[model samples]
Target: MTDEPDDLSDQPPLVQALLLARYTLVIHSGMRAVSEGETWKLDFASQIAEIDAALQTAGIDTTKPMFAPVKW
Candidate 1:
């Protein structure tokens, strides 16, 4: 119970959006046939689509360093 809470809001908007997308997929994983997450795939995909639109409107640059491809 001594663990500190991880707050998403404390992160930048792009970071928050990316984590939210991952979270949506993970939560919908139960309906999956693979990592692609079968039945719930479209649901999460659409949700992410909305998130993408919002991010675009917010003018967040996803190409920033925080979003660069990781080697590991």
Candidate 2:
């Protein structure tokens, strides 16, 4: 309903977990896409990798798949 949250601390635990899960899902999808797409997408892949790293730096556990791979 409101603008996207910039900080997850203010959100509830369930929200925080869900957001992290969503980010994980996006990262997974991007990875798969970059793998299948053309070389120019390397830039996009790098950005996705950065997001993935940031999520990890925040201590998000990415070992477990949260949402399924996005069917684009």
Top of the candidates by lDDT: 1
Q: Write down the lDDT of every candidate, Cα atoms only.
A: 0.53, 0.52
For candidate 1, the lDDT comes to 0.53
Q: Which residue pairs collide, candidate 2? A: none
Looking at candidate 1, the ten consecutive residues that score lowest on lDDT are 62-71
TM-score per model over all chains? 0.39, 0.36
**Tens digits of per-residue lDDT for model 1, 1-72:** 223543556678676867567556646644645455544333466665666567667664432323322335
Clashing pairs in 1: none
Error of 2 at 39 (Å): 17
Best by TM-score: 1
- Number of clashing pairs per prediction, in order: 0, 0
Q: Give residue 72's lDDT in candidate 1 (0 to 100).
A: 56
